[model samples]
Target chain A: MTDVLSGLEAGFAVALLPLNLALVMGGCFVGTLIGALPGIGPINGVAILLPIAYGLGLPPESALILLAGIYYGAEYGGRISSILLNVPGDAGAVMTTLDGNPMAKRGEAGRALSLSAVASFCGGTAAVILMTLFGPLLASFAVKFNPSNYVALMVFAFASLASLVGKNPIKTLLGAVIGLMLATIGIDANTGVARYDFGVPDLLAGIDFLVVVIGLFGMAELIHLVEQQVTGKFTILPIGKSFVSMADLMATKWTILRSSLIGFFIGVLPGTGASVASAVAYGTEKRLASDGDTFGTGNPKGLAAPEAANNAAAGGAMVPMLTLGIPGSGTTAILLGALLLFNVTPGPMMFQTRPEIAWGLIASMYIGNVALLVINLPLVGLFARMLTIPQRYLIPLIAVLAFIGVYSVVGNPFDLFMIIGLGIFGWVLRKLHFSLAPIILGFVLGGLFEDNLRRALSISGGDWSILVADANSLVLYTLALLVVAVPLVLSRRKRMALDTEA
Target chain B: MADRIFSGLLLLVSIGYGVMAFTVIKAPFQYDPLGPESWPRILSVVSALCCLGLLARPDTERLDLTGKTSTRLVVLLVLLAAYAALFEPLGFVIATLLFCAVLARILGATMGHAMIFGVATGILGFGVGAMILELNLPAGPLRALM
Candidate 1:
């Protein structure tokens, strides 16, 4: 307890720095704007700003604080479009639209916005508290893991992603495999042999993660927006009152608490993200609540459940990234890439080596969440108005930012074309109903996965049995198997039950 | 139809990768039991299997790649490619101006509005990138004038 308190105190010392505090507020503001813009999600927002953040030369902790602020802020801001425009700002906000848009239609837009903000605060704060207590304990356990154990852990990560990420496991798995293959397109550091470089000098350094992110999320998102312009129309609701009654708060108090708990735990699970968290929480509430039929009819509890869960999940996803060096969500993968850029390897050792960076980020999230609640409640009108911004203006800015982000970071004209190519590929993949997150996770984990696998084999002198010899690895492998098997079993039983009913 | 074609392409790529993994990837000396080739070989086999699964059970979905959409997309892509080609020689501000203006015009903005937005975004973006970020975005011919 003392250790946590002291560490938190130390973290506050860093997070409370004038510059860091400014960054948190600034990031939250920008994040909210991005989140309010439909078709631009947190991933695109972060990917676009990442290079600029790095170029600004902020300290690692400060940059993390800013980025973390953007992350949680986007979670908060995603509700804006869902409520007023009936369009989700991000995938995590999809559930919010069910009840939120109905509420807006009923002229409760203000009440819904304020209530969801409060719910977000409760969820985000609650998740941070849980993360503070659980993160260190998990790291302490993970620190004991050996090379073989880590290889098993990586397997567990991949298995969870393939089974949990998208509608089709095969598509998800293929996406991951493609990502891993892309990660191999450079010189092999260990053997000093190039594989698939095609004799290009620019290929020697491997494909930059920034290029991939901007290409897939930023540039591709612009292309998606262009399509949206053809298919969809924008009509935003007038925000009504901007205030919630005390009775409304009392009605949703328990829903917020329960969804926060649900969201936090799901977030801690590998491969799942806010989309899953919000869906599960909303579904659970709908099933458990007596007024379940009122769920899609603008029920305040329905709105609160997903709003709380997604914010809580955002905080929850940080635990694994901080402790085990594995990203719990797509956004965290970008964060992991950012840490690597700053030469800060996040793992169990991060606590001992750079407590400030780790704890400071946690501390800043608390403040950022609060800052978002305050900023969102008052300026939501401004943000909601942003929904009126035309595609012509918005699309151009995204294109320009993508170009600047790539050129500033990689400084190669070839990467400029590379992003455009990747953007097209990403658009085609999205059209095929293939989730892109698995590819990112696979890419980010590819090096670590191969490194640990080879090390384990080397230590065992080519005997693969060492992977199964240790209890930790055995446990991890079993967990991996269970993660894949349980879903298949449950679905099969569901089918059988339906057949019997038929 | 798109899924089938994409999967077939993926299969071909995987086969090519597997062949290269075996034939091209060689270590001067063995540093570990599992060499660089082993990982790629594993990935290629898995990828090939997954691609086969996708091909066998291709998603029965249709894409709306209408003539208009395709024309706009191709023009946008060409404009983007040209932006890259011109980024070094034309400089950030001018290149971004032309790109954004043409893009805006394509997306249904008036020519005047597109030009105005292009100038505002280009000059403003360059200002922030150069002055605030301290990044060395190429100034090109403008450098001699400055």
Candidate 2:
């Protein structure tokens, strides 16, 4: 109870600032607009906004608050497009359309849209409240993480993230290695020397997070979509179809709460991110629903679970990053980069020295989430109109925006080339049934892992015993071994079976 | 194109990364506690093994890039390369629209769609880039004028 009151109090105090409030409102609105746009997502949107946020002279907390608003706002907004059009604006919304678009097609678009909007509100709100209450407690624990403990923590995150998808461990590791390589492209932070710049001046600064993300999410997707225009059979719903009903809301309430909690827990795990949370939540809900008959065919619970989980996951994912300085996803890593750029390391020190920054961000999550719910629910009708735009025109707009968004950041077209290159690569990776989330997690966490490894070694004077010298390290290492070994053993059995058949 | 070539390329990349990792300055350890070079080097070796694994095992999901589709992606990639290289020289608006229009055309958009896309995208991109995102888009010839 004290923790709850303190969290609420801290949140209210930090969030009550007029500038912070305005930033939250503006960020959410932009996030919704970006989400409403076909093909762009919160990651791309936040990434695109990074340069502007830095340029605007906003403090770190304000910028973080704004980014959070946009992040959650995008998650909520994505369902609108997914339901109205058969297209998912981002991967997180992919499951949403399994049920969301069908209801839209059945002239229940408004009901589907509103149900999602409200369910998202409940999930997002519930998670943010939990985040507000527990984030500080977690931060206190995180503050005490020694260098060795952090190294162990990161290792656990990497292994767990790799294991999230049941099949394709090799592919996961390959993608992860590639991501880590990308993470290492710039200068070596410790040595202040360039590692893999390959004499390119642009690479000396390292591949900008925005560059990789925009290219990874935006321009590349454009290329792949064009290449695979095998889908001329998509349907569109007329604007203003009433998909929402009080009944739909009631049916999804339990699913929303359950998914929200699940998403929050998943979010807290390093590298788990929203996609895993949503997929797991959807999978769980499918198994749990007695009316499994209704799911994936316009069931409100189907849309509600994943939508809620993904949004709640977005809120929940922030816990580890702010507390431990270890980002859960690529987007948060980019946010971490931004925080570092602002001279604020997001570890326990942040809580001690900058309570406003820490508490304020927590507080803004509450305000931002509520603001998003209110904004997206009423404006669902308008955002749904986005689906009516002819694909002929739509693809071009996305392509152009993608190119421009990539180009404006760092003002180099080589980055643009890399985006297209990575896009093509991403498209191929997607087709292989390999998930991209692990690769991103590996990329974002790679340097943190390396930096900590180096630090621990330096402290121990290159001794091999320091990692095992502590209880925390022992626990983390044990977890990592269990994750790596058990999965390998289990999956090897399946692989052998497949091999025998082959 | 993806089967044999991608594997070979990945193998080369892994070897190259391994060589780079081996050259990194780290104290050599006899046993367990891995150094900075350990993970990267291990990744390089493992990645190379994975590449070989791909070679030994055929890709069941064969990537079918037709000559036309191959030409489309390859040309699109090259055009992107050139587009990025000339962005500031041609002005962001012109370069971006041309890039989008060409991409749309190659992707099977009709001329009407391409033109509408080019114009609307240029205008909208300029608005968002300059006004909203606040990122500087080089106006090329308009550079001095602006």
Top DockQ hit: 1
Q: CA shift at A301, candidate 2, in angstroms? A: 2.5
* Candidate 2, superposed: residue stretches over 4 Å from native: A1-16, A52-57, A230-233, A239-243, A482-502, B1-5, B24-39, B49-60, B104-120, B131-134
lDDT, candidates in the order shown = 0.89, 0.75
lDDT of 1 by residue, A364-471 (tens): 987888888888888889998878898888988898888888888778999999999999999989889888888887888888888888999999999999989889
Interface RMSD of 1: 1.3
Model 1 alpha-carbon drift over 4 Å, by segment: A231-233
lDDT score of residue A427 within candidate 1: 90
Per-residue accuracy of model 2 over A36-98 as CA lDDT, tens digit each: 766666776776566667656688888888888888888888887788777787778888889
- Residue-pair clashes, model 2: 10
Prediction 1 global C-alpha lDDT: 0.89
